[model samples]
Target chain A: MAERTPTQTPATVASPDPAAPPPRRRRRMKDLRKQPGFDTMAWFCLFCLYAPIAVLVVFSFNDNRSVVRWTEFSLRWYRAAFENDGIRHATWISLQVAFVAMVFATTFATMAALATTRVRAFKGQTLTYAVINQPLMVPEIVTAVSTLAFFVLIKQVTGLNGIGFLMLAHTVFCIPFAYMPIRARLEDMNLTLEQAAADLYGTPFQVFRTVTLPLMAPGIVAGAMLAFVVSLDDVIITLLVGGPGETTLPVYIFGQIRRGITPEINAVSTVLLGLSALLVSIFFLIGNKRK
Target chain B: MATQTEIRDPGTPQAAAAQDVMIHAEGVIKTFGEGAGKITALDNVTVDIRKNEFFTLLGPSGCGKTTLLRLIAGFELPDRGQILLDGQEIGHLPPYKRPVNTVFQSYALFPHMSVARNIGFGLEMQGRPKAEIKTATEEMLALVQMEHLANRQTDQLSGGQQQRVALARALAPRPKVLLLDEPLSALDLKLRKEMQIELKRLQGETGITFVFVTHDQEEALTMSDRIAVMQAGCILQVGTPKEIYNNPARRFVADFIGDINILEGELQQDGGAVLLPGGASIGALLPEGAARSGKVSIAIRPENMGLTAPDAADASLTGEVTNIVYFGAGHNVHVALDGGGEVLVRRAQTDAQVGAKVGLAVPDAVQVLVD
Candidate 1:
């Protein structure tokens, strides 16, 4: 008893002190804690994500080239941003790329999503699924390298410096991104509405045109917006494949940053930020309205 | 099977029933799949639903009654036979093209549309005038007593209300025949009974041939002018509710139609009497050559018999009382008869008490159906 007294006492004191109260408290608090929880880990992750972006937005308005210390507020850099021909040209190119890429991506995404979900079983199902999901599974660097190799091979064989290749590559990368949402929407849609339409004497084509397409509009729009945003902000795939005349906004932003940290870039960043946020908010509003 | 349908049903409109072949099926066979794996859902089935009659397909689940309804509705094509509606071969007609509308088991109300839109859906699709659709939709909704709630969403309404809307929608089309698939099963008990009466009334007021399907025996007895009891994808018996309940042709039909005691026995047929395996004889008289002296079974309804003390001189059988149940209208007594047989006897509340010793006296003519 005397020899074991000290060790037993220390074990009881330390073990209970560390975990017993916590275990009991954790068990008791579950009901209350579960009701209004936002998942602390998730909230913390989002805080980590947006806090730096907030700092970037705040610093973009910083008055001086060296933004660490706030000097004075000024619009000089913002004015300079508007006048920069390279930024303007890059912005126009980004808009054009985004428009072209999204149109191609959304159309192909809708067709692909419908085809995948409609055909019950086929020999190429596995192969087709794998090919479509390849961009998600493979490393971005591997895709960039392979795409560059493929583009160079195409040019060597055809003797055409095709600018459309970059847009196609960006579109290819965005298909799965666009397709995930549309396919999920299509798969989750109830088939009874369409059946009711058919029973009411509407032909299959009429049912699809009137009922199915309208119900799926939100998904299509959301997917197209996602593709547009992805194409606008693309850097790795664009850098690997884009020609000298077709520099997108992100690449232009990158080249500017490499040369120097200027206030003009900050103004351009602010405009791009506003545009993307507006697009996402609009996407969410329309998406939730239908479902 | 010989058709025992009364050629001149008092309820049938004269003009409609005058058309001999109002709706008939000739060996209609509908198989689900192909080859060896196929399920013969309907097998050489034939029945005629005389116009303006509430003809019910009565059966347990998987009995192919609803399949028969779907075939008539043109929702399904028979594998090897033809179905004629109003003496026309509608064998290949689609549901929309055929002048028949189905009230599906689930009601199949479009979740996205309102009650008014759903009721007017068929009219709208037919490209009818907007005013006509609105008037007809309102009139049909009013007929079902659901006009006040026409603007409410389909998903927002109660099950019974939704069923009413479905009825309204199907009725608005004014098809030649209205096909209902267990429509009342989706409602509560009270609502189901109420809707059954309402449905019969609707059939009367509309004067449309309602070919309905139901598994509930009491419901079929109450509503159907004629019923077809199906088992294992074939029609076993078709008769009026009274005929099916009282004069069921086979032991199975009698047992299934209502609560009846199936007494399997040996027959000792004499000139006017028939003795049983349990040595109890029934029927004071039988027509000559009615049955041979051999094995037979009789279906005895619980309500047709009474009990006397077990020691009485004219006792049907000596027995001890086992249990007594209080049915609201009567008391049902379970007695262990002599020689280890159990019999259920129903009586008015004043007729018998629990544990009372009694002999049974089944009526001389309680419709003794032998098989």
Candidate 2:
């Protein structure tokens, strides 16, 4: 690219020189055209990435039952989704599960981040960090199976079957997702502020409350959002751990897709996508405000 | 200055008679990490910081100066030792319980808080009344000349402004002793110089004992009433600036404090002079150990030596001028002797060239270091 820029400059500079040969001038013009050409591969890659999402979004308002056939633009699927009993119940369950998982996962992850990043070296610190990040490294199916087996054992010991178990599974799976951002923030924080707080007559707990916690607020919010999104979108863990009446929105969508493709699923998915995008924007705004 | 002389010899009867001992650290040892990777940050260090004195701990990086400061502030507990503040052993107490505050090197101003809030944070932590905190915060802001920036966020302020805010915040609570860990190091040269004097003035006005740590020897000399020169976790010497510079107790102290040309020689039989290997006998204060060993190093400050004609009668040694370094105010004439040693004589702008033969005249009060 740099070589081309130099070559093109000489061509324009020699444009008014009649002494220059016509063939060479024509070749230079061709070269100039070629140098300013568009990157086809980049456009192809972008299209490949966004085309499916575009199709999903456009087809979400399809008037026909078949998602592939768009007879006319209509809001029937959205209205139908809102009025459906099973979808509504599953959406409510998903909201409850996501809220619970987000709160617990964010709290536990923030503690883990502080313990690993703020505290100095201790016995088994590396092992503890690795254990906290275990779910992120393992396959989601493996986590689903292990959590299913663990919940089965718990149920055998004490008869429990409800959204509570599903919420616990989602929280366990979302911990690593939440841990990443919170730990990164803690590591990036300047430690001298906390030391200064302590030196300024703040107790250990007071230092955390006044300095560390306020500074780590953005990371906590981001981590909570990430955990909420992960729990809301989870299918395998919910399917494996949930019993009857505990089917979340994603699981219901999967069941509907397995039965048949419907515009209602697309409409529900678009809404979820919009919700996640809104959350991500909020995260970025908070991050920028802090900066 | 009189009190400085009285506390100069901390181990002597004069220092024991003085009633201004604010903090006394005895056999303080701190180690980091464990096993093979362990580092002894402070090794059996003992020192006494006097009341209302601008005492500085001067050393290079990793010299345990910062560790000592942190130990005094109760940020880090000593592995084994006692730290007594106001005659009470408070080594095991947490930082909040101690009557001390620290101005960290990075300023460490709370980025989220305004300058006023940052200054008031300490008083708030102490559970002071809201009205009292506001008054004290405003007073501290005025002390640091930062009242105009009272409501501004700390992150919006310049480096010097943030530094003032940090100082104001630390001083608002009126700590008995204040620990400053290279607070001026982050500022530019001019700002650092201004703050050095400002800090001394503040210390004088408040009558708070300041334990400042810095690697810059000039800053230590200019601002401190007395300095503890540390190296490798040990305090080599503790004395006033004039005493530390003019009568360094050890070779490291003499070399670390300022530029000096060390001349290796043997102590004379009378124990009042050193016989140089370059056929020159110079008067020196011989230590008892050097008297027994007959070996010593004569540390002559470059400014203390003079350059003269090669065959001058008062010249103690003769050498060829090897190099000349100009410092605008003066020139350092590097002289090489026939006996394979070099000495730098500081001179004003002179006609002496690099290859000119010159005679070096040493003053009578050269420091004689045994180690």
Candidate 3:
């Protein structure tokens, strides 16, 4: 109990000068940030990821016909993409699918998220969560193949071969993308706010309309945007499920690639990339603003 | 000076009237989880809160004060028994169907709504006319003195401002009863003191039965008309501040509310005088129907006893001053008695020296505690 530590040593304390300036210490935080090779490794990884996309974007504006070798900047490929009947028709189809799928997916995701989060623990809750997020975990190729087989059987039974099958496939796959942000938002939401609303004489439906919906608007918008981008950029599922002449932009671009590599393909891909980037940026903005 | 504030027998003609009882909870029990993980939050609690009274539930954490408040608010339903509001059983009603509102401990204001809109929410939900809702909302804003911040979003306000908004919002609908779950706990000391007075005034002005819950004994004493002291999911005692402080029904209430010294004692064969551990005797102030001849525990408030000379004839116990702790107003003298126990004595000024022998002169206010 009487043991003395170094700080309690009388000799060291007595030896210190009263008026001397203290020694300058190196900051540990700045030193940690400047760890050797870290900056280089980070930049190299970013470059590896984005360098090919950057090349594709630049080549999309090439004046020459060669896809990889850019000679001079021109809007010729963009103009060609705009004027091409097949590309125009496929893009319109893609937009319609994305819009319709986004609406349905966001609705289902919101309901599913609320069901899983805003209630007491019940049987099959874990399994319900798993099923909601199943599409996100499963491989895209497997989903595409299964949907293709399912739609083929449906066509034979119903004697229908409309674009409904492709729309259904996109909507199904986009659910988990939409569900992720919505469920996260619902989880982060304060439970007491809803309780307070109920305490204020708002019925269950009224509380949902007045309090829960308004607070959840940002998450719903973000989820919808993410779902739109995901559906718009989908290639495998669209290709597998689309009927003749019901090709989407990504599938149409795939068919063009098989025929021959053209600067027009780069142009179309760049447009798709830009659209996805714009929507994803909007999604991020809405998501981050909630905090 | 308030005494005999216990729950009267319901079979009495006066007790059955029910007009003054704003909220009555009978044999209420609430438990969380199921099977082995179950924890009973409230155990057979039954109490009556009078109309227009600032009633408070005071206890330490997990003592079921907030749980009881929530039960009255209709946020949590009792697994057994019934809660009555003005003689009507409301235990089965949902929160929205019940005519009560809560100022949550966290002050759960809607972040998206402006101050005025938030206050108007309950009115709007009731489908009141636009003009009436606006008038009531404006009146509530003026009541809480937040009229200038009417259009400001809730997230823009400070802690105290948000607390006022929450109070205003809950009060807008003018419910018959208001449940405040430690609303002032989030405030700093000076602000909390201010809000305590403000809440008491609001309760008076609105004539709403306020069931406040807090762990702070000072807050309960300052604001409540009557306080219910709880421990381990049961109400230990129910009385006004004076009664609770002076005549604690349980040792837990005595030790919890203020500085109290409990000593082991025994009642004499004739039940006239109680024998202290240090061979001193004092007249027994036993409650009716209590044990007449047995070992018992006794509680005395620190300030109620005085320090005297070691050989004083009227001394109830003798001890040595072990420690002296100073506060701005007074000091507490910790004493180690010769009978192998410790007691704390509060003194405005003490002449006794540390480690010196002293005598404690017990007053007639010594409370005999039941187990």
Candidate 4:
């Protein structure tokens, strides 16, 4: 088997030489062309996915109020978005909620992921895994409505309603999103290192702090970024559960859309899109570093 | 060979007192899973490892050797007994509290740390001074001859190199005992052989009780001062390598340790002799209280049987050579006996071709086993 590998390369390289007969060359070209439409469909899907976002980004610089028409290129809406007081307040609220939610979600999700992946097999392991992932399996609108009802019930019983409620709702919704990467990282880890650490006089907590946690950093960072993005972009749940003075950026943008289609909305959406792209790029950077 | 005779009688008071026992496991039982799915990993396993001796748990995979090692290391808790280290009961202590370290089968080096850091990690966990850790880490690196690769990440090292680093790391803290779980199983045959010698040298120099676990019988024989052969969660026998190889206590032990030919026969009226069904009589050791009429099994090592010309005067049995397997060091001649049995004779070199008739001679000390 080892000897055959070196011989195989020269045969493949020599077959593609121009010195080869034209008939065989034509047959090889035909074979290459005979591939199925998977590549074409992939290209089509990519264009479909990115074209809308590209258009929205381009129109964010439009001078005119209309978003559909291509007018003179300007930063008019960007300046308008920056100047708007309501947008600014809503952006602040969204940042606060996303930051807090990211922290709590990442912490709880990391713990949940470790418990589900690292713990030995138990009777309720499968059930616990399913329950942790329930938020991702349920529809977004259902989560929003159910959370709203739950909050209403809590308010009826204890009368607690504020930005705290919105933050809590977002944290719950973002848990599965954060959990996925952390769990994947935990599962990918070589468990023997932890065992070796324990054998080398490291206590359980010491092993976790010295070996498991450092190895899990990439996944935790990625999960935190994902949770942040999800919390930042959430609109339905915020609209349903948020009280006055608790409007997030997405909720504010939805209100602006209902009032009218403005380039300012496109400008804000472009900024949000850029932020998410930056977060995603950071996630990939950490992932690549781990590799 | 001299050491083998010295430790031959493990029950002797002088031997037991001279070599202080390091680890003692008493009626240890461990089971995995619950109810119907439960699998008994170790069943009432009791063994004493002498201080500073190179002890081995030798068996095939799933024979509970690794479970026994883990039990002593405190990675596992026994359902029904105690494990003692230097006369201290350590069964209730977690792995970290136990004064033992394991070189994992996978090497399990911390991929993110440098070789030096990996070797120093245990010391750091002990809260050793930085200067002391540095000096000790360099000493360990020197011991393993990995000083040139001290700064290299563990992932950058080869399998053999990583194994050394793991050993260095486990040894840095200078534990009273070290456990190695098939540490050389990942290396190629040549490197595995080299590491085997190196491991023995290290164990001798450090004078730490080394409990090595492996399924490779040759490796166990080459490295262990004393070996405990395990099967089906029970210890079949414990003896020196020479003792285990020459005088196996069970059929499984005989078959597992090395090449052997087993012949079924009945004990003759004259003791110390077995009569085959084909009317061939072979010398053997008769067990005490043996039934004078029932069948018995005799086992002989392939190397012990000699091959002679068919017309030789003292030939006990005649057979036709069926096959010859050449193993560079020696060759095995497979013979089909005329009496409806087959045996293999190990020879240095043989001009005997296939289909040549050969005479076989069985030694006097054939192992007799009664079922």
Candidate 5:
């Protein structure tokens, strides 16, 4: 029919091939070979992103104290950072905080995403979403100050003191980060699958469990990673709200930086940077797999 | 010319109630927007969909055809009517609670799930035993001939392949009714034609009531056991494909269904002959007790417009062949009438040419659209 129609019909040629794979491959090949100004601009943008990470990797192996200057290569800081008890304890605290915060963040983000996208009408939806995103919108200092004030007020009423409040505060900040990714994932998801599931004898709740939740996993995983990063790196919120013996890694690193220049601090920073890099690499490896 | 009209549904009112009517919708009304200015999507539409039948809601895009499909699927709530599934009022029930499924136009297979998982999802939700889900999923996958790709992710499959997976997924549970909303509309023309046959085959194999919604005339005609042609928000007519195409009850139905050569004529000769608007006389074998008088229209299929060179006086509107299009299957010739209006003649491409002056016989091509 195509052979016949192409000979006779004057309609525009939109080949019925839905597999656009070959064209995409050919386009990439053509662009690489041509190397236009647009290619230079794109490469320059990539260099802008990658150069700092390169510098950070180089500095991790440097013997010098400064971030830029390099001396003889050494693994001394990495070894020392691994050995320091304060750094180890702080790392453990950050891990605990991130782990706990992830649980809260994933749950809240999922519920919030569902409520935002599903259900016909809900009272104060925009307000609820804005409140969920408060940690991201308001200044970190403001959040810290508010967390302190809220904790003090709680203590004044009925004392519930500990870094537990600090964890909760960090969870609040991680929500928007988590919610951002989950919501974006939800936006990409097609609603027809849920409808199809329902039509195929699944109850609304069953459809969510079998269809919607499974489809949203990738997004939930992304949100969890973002939440973990936020929780681990949080300084202002933990600094103001964390109680005794609950100093987070960033707080510990802050104190060290203020004190004096030392290989121990560099060692600790290197370890922290390594963990983040590991997490980021895993995130991309899992998340960026194409169909 | 008082010939009898042998309608399948006898004119007696009792015939409407006595049948194996699987679905009964009573006076369904749906209105969008609110208050006095509300737009009526379905205006008191009442239809009975029979069991194991291929039924189509055929109409233009916004003619409440999809709204009716949704109403049947429990996705939509009619404003002031109840629908009964197996004689139980289930219109108010949500889509999940209803014993029906839909094959969406988008073929919405879960992108994250493997084809087997996608098809087995409904069984999993019902807490079916693992072995049962596994066996049933395999059978369904085999039914759609997608068993080979069971472990493959849905997003990786082609559009037609994904559509088959969606079909397997929907048909896995074996619902009482299968509502398809323009299911083949998203596919390429060749694939759409292929899926049409596959859908029909599957419908026969499963023996479930299929409520298909489509704006394509040929798709509706080729697939449905009965088609309900709708306009605006009202059903213009409902009949078998042959009935709708061969004997259209309205002018719009004639125009919408397929290529029809329409000739405007004044009702004359006490309903014997029609004096065409272009002053050409033509004869019609009118249906008994049909149109009355004055202004009327005559419609005939393009193939029914026969050519007799240019030597006739009392024939279908005599026209000169302006252009001929070779559509592979047949030659569609465009003809300009000597009076005013034009005529389209479709003939076998075996022996036809362009710019050939021809006289069309109007004896069979004339029908009293209005009288």
Candidate 6:
């Protein structure tokens, strides 16, 4: 300790009582930030992940008509995107589909989560969990193809081709996303509280309404927001299952990108990104508040 | 405690049973799991809990005390026999339908609600009017001395405060019986002692039957009016605290309840005394229906025996003092017996040092254990 102190001491001040050996001998510690190339690698990863989104957001305010060129700042693309009838129609369709699917998905997810968690373990519990999460495990392209085939079979039989099929497909695909948060909340809840409620003369239904629902409300809201985001971002299933008049925002954006890139599309994409960010932030706030 | 007895059915046995008993479990057998892994949590356990009494089911962990309490609370059904509440078979009823409430071991306070809301929950669930619920909640808050913190969230309270809230919530609906599942186990030692007195006071004030389950023998003795000592999914004995401590019916009870010295002996021909291995005879108090002749085991509490001079007349056995442990109130002297085995004698003060020869005096209250 005595030999190491002189080498470790800083030269900022004259050594005070050399025999005492400085008050604290500094130790060399392994710091990730100080490692060579660590900060650069981290910044490069972030830039790769977010630079395109940043460019799109910055260029959305450009007044020039050329998509690649930037002029003085303006909100013309945002205005144009809002004023265009096709964008409005597609956005309305997207909102309607996401709202309906979110409600159905969240409701079913809550029930499934409760059924699997609140009750005593039974036969096929693992199988039930696996089936609930099957959509999340299976590739989206496969789900879209199978759903399209099934919907085509239904249309051939009953002549039923409507936006309901798109909503149904989205709900089925979003159930797992909605289930994850609600299940986590239910598992974290104290089982004794429900038992206490029941002991206090609350019937099963009354207990759910008075105690369980109020306690798990944050998880339900979080799950609903997640399901809404998932449904709104869906492209493959929406494109395959949507009827002729049921063009959603993502499908419309895909069609626009195929034809050509435009500032209006950038504006629309930026708005979608902003909506998703807002909903995700709300989800995180609810989850943290529960803690 | 005066019971208002109705003369309408004076001769009926059922009425007589209902007048005194709050809950009675007969031949209850509850098993968990299936096949080889199954465990019998309650093995034909029979018990009677009287009205307005602090009845405790005392045992170590996994001894079926909590299972019995759960059966009374309608959380679990018996595989065989019945549980009657005031002469009504309630084993089939759900917890909500039973006129009983429970203070869970965890307290299980609702995190989303305030203290007042938690206390008033039972009353509100009963469909009582808003004014009545508020009045009852206030009364409960006052009962638990928590009126000042009634508006605070349950999570803000300390352990003891949460316990008080749990007790108040269970009592709010004025249930016929209140079940507490080791509610004081979560508190510190000092707080636990305080809650013991508080629980007994609340039981007396409310005049409601309390069936408390706990593994702590001291807590059971301090708070229970009567305790059922359970082991291996069966109740070994049931009696008042003094009766259980003085005359434990089984060897397990004597060892489990407190510090007891179990000595092997042979009963004399007259059956009035037991002869210890060291050629000394001590008087024995055999329980009712005990065997008259054979090898026997006896239990004597440490406090009942004492260290005497080696040649004293009352000395039952002579031994050497091996170790002395000092407690705040007294000291426990360990004496290695002359022939075999060891005994501990508790004394307020002792002059005999280590390696000193001492005589162990047997107590008059010798409980001959029935294995």
Q: In TM-score terms, which candidate is top? A: 3
User: DockQ of each model against the real complex?
Assistant: 0.14, 0.31, 0.33, 0.34, 0.34, 0.33
Estimate the TM-score for candidate 5.
0.83
Give me candidate 6's interface root-mean-square deviation.
15.2
What CAPRI-style quality would you assign to candidate 2? acceptable
lDDT of 6 by residue, B1-117 (tens): 011111112244533355698898888889999999999998888777899999999999999999999988989989987999998999989999999999999899999999999
Model 2 misplacement above 4 A: A1-39, A287-291, B1-14, B277-282, B286-293, B308-313, B323-326, B349-358
Fnat values, one per model, are 0.26, 0.67, 0.67, 0.59, 0.66, 0.69
Structural RMSD, model 5: 6.0
Residue B356 CA displacement from its true place in model 2, Å = 5.0
What lDDT is obtained when candidate 6 is compared to the true structure? Answer: 0.88
Task: Tell me how far the alpha carbon of residue B53 in candidate 1 is from the true structure, in angstroms, after superposition.
Answer: 2.6
> What is candidate 5's lDDT per residue for A195-241, written digit by digit as tens?
88777778877888877887788888888887898798888888888
What does the interface RMSD come to for each candidate?
A: 18.9, 14.3, 14.7, 9.4, 6.5, 15.2
Question: Please, what are the lDDT tens digits per residue for candidate 6 over residues A27-142?
Answer: 22335467899889989999999999999998888898777788889999999999999999999999999999999999999999999999999999999999999999898899
Report the lDDT of model 5 for residue B306.
70
In candidate 4, position B290 carries an lDDT of 44
Clashing pairs in 2: none
TM-score of chain A of 3: 0.88
Candidate 6 residue pairs in backbone clash: none
Return the lDDT, model 3, position B64.
Answer: 88
Fraction of native contacts, model 1 = 0.26
Candidate 5 residue-wise lDDT at A122: 69
Residue-level error in angstroms, candidate 4, position B326: 4.6
Reference contact recovery of candidate 4? 0.59
Candidate 1 has an interface RMSD (Å) of: 18.9
